[model samples]
Target: MADDSKSGGDLEKDQRSQEDAPPSSIYLISYPKIVFLYPTFLVAVVVAIFMSIAGESAQIGGNREHMAEVMSLIFLGVFGLNLTVLAFDFPRTTSLTLFFLGAALFMGAWMLLRFNPDIVPTITGLLKGLRPWANSQMYWLFASILGLIFIGVAISVRFDYWEVKGNELLHHHGFLSDLERFAAPNLKIDKEISDIFEYLLLRSGRLVLHPRNQPRAIVLDNVPFISRKEKQITRMLGALQVQVRPDNH
Candidate 1:
């Protein structure tokens, strides 16, 4: 009876300690700075809005000539937004950004050729001075789609949060009430530095963890500053054993 009571008390104490532990400090392994990118994007948005208004006025006035300028401005705005996403460290962001950038460049080239036939002498000579009217509707349509994609990516990244606590890793993704937890206790962690560009740019690091009784390993890629993360994981694991650098490896 006495032994049972003593075991119960110890279990309660352990539970209390775990419950009382402080929350982990979340770290963004890699996030791009908004300072430089935001300004350029803002400028592009302003230009687009101005061009949109001007184009509408021109259409109302029956001029219809200023429509090309409006399309160019809208393209510029999309290009700027794409640049901003590229500035962010998101991998998929770059692909989408590049796609939009390429589309904008293609459209811009077409618009230039359409408005200024003399600029492309070969095409002008071949076509015999055929001019294409600017498609104002398509200009705003593509811009709106690109803008929505940009906003979606931004929101997704902003809401995703990841952190490491003592012997545990937590990820909170999505808008609200969505959480995922992963925990490993005093497990062996190995880090490998690969990629020549990663070494030069100092932006890539890999974390490999071998957990007990787990057939598969946990691998984290594109982690920044390996040494610091190694130390953090080391300290957290060491705390479990009440000793640093266990000889067992």
Candidate 2:
């Protein structure tokens, strides 16, 4: 019974020790802007599947034609919107909201006008003729290209990333795995979300790291989950600071 009690006490102590242990390291990866085109890539795949199914069925001519037209419009709209997002920056949530609201209002008006052909026959005629239909193969090709790009982006980021340890910051880059180290003690970090759209897409932002004795701050952009990363870094450095502080009598 004494042996059993001693074993239980030892197990409890081990668990406590493990629970108090700090993280070994935190890795930060910054993705390129092209990652935002995931929406277009996904839409292309979906549209390709739909087109493939429609092409297989020879009996439903009218329905297939209607679906093709609708899908074409949807693809064009998504592509245009994605391009616009890539071209412009929405720095604030208010501006992003207003942009979306205005787009919705414009689409609603266009839809109303489209349904009521008699309102403006000339515009209705032009809209009716604007069926931007394409073969399933085209969509598949588009999806394939985007898929390859995404894969490349994923692989490329692995070669260029930052690692934060309790005592040092590391930059691991290049195909040969070149590493650069910086003092992490007393490191200053700042988080900035410059674009709301990018943030909404991936919870991404910029992380500025000021290492001790460094003249310039290291700026990492498009870092996903910026807030969580900042907190973990703070916790790691805070614990280090507490451990290294001199005890006063």
Best by lDDT: 2
How does model 2 fare in lDDT? 0.88
| lDDT measured at residue 188 in model 2 versus the true structure, 0 to 100 | 98
Choose the strongest candidate by TM-score: 2
Ten-residue stretch with the least lDDT total in model 2: 56-65
Runs in model 1 deviating more than 4 A are 1-23, 27-44, 56-67, 70-161, 171-181, 184-213, 217-249
- Model 1 root-mean-square deviation: 13.5
Superposed Cα deviation of residue 243, candidate 1 (Å):
6.1
Candidate 2, residue 144: lDDT: 100
Q: What is the per-residue lDDT of model 2 for residues 39-109, given as tens digits with 9 covering 90 to 100?
A: 99999999999889877333336544566667778999999888877888888957668888998999987
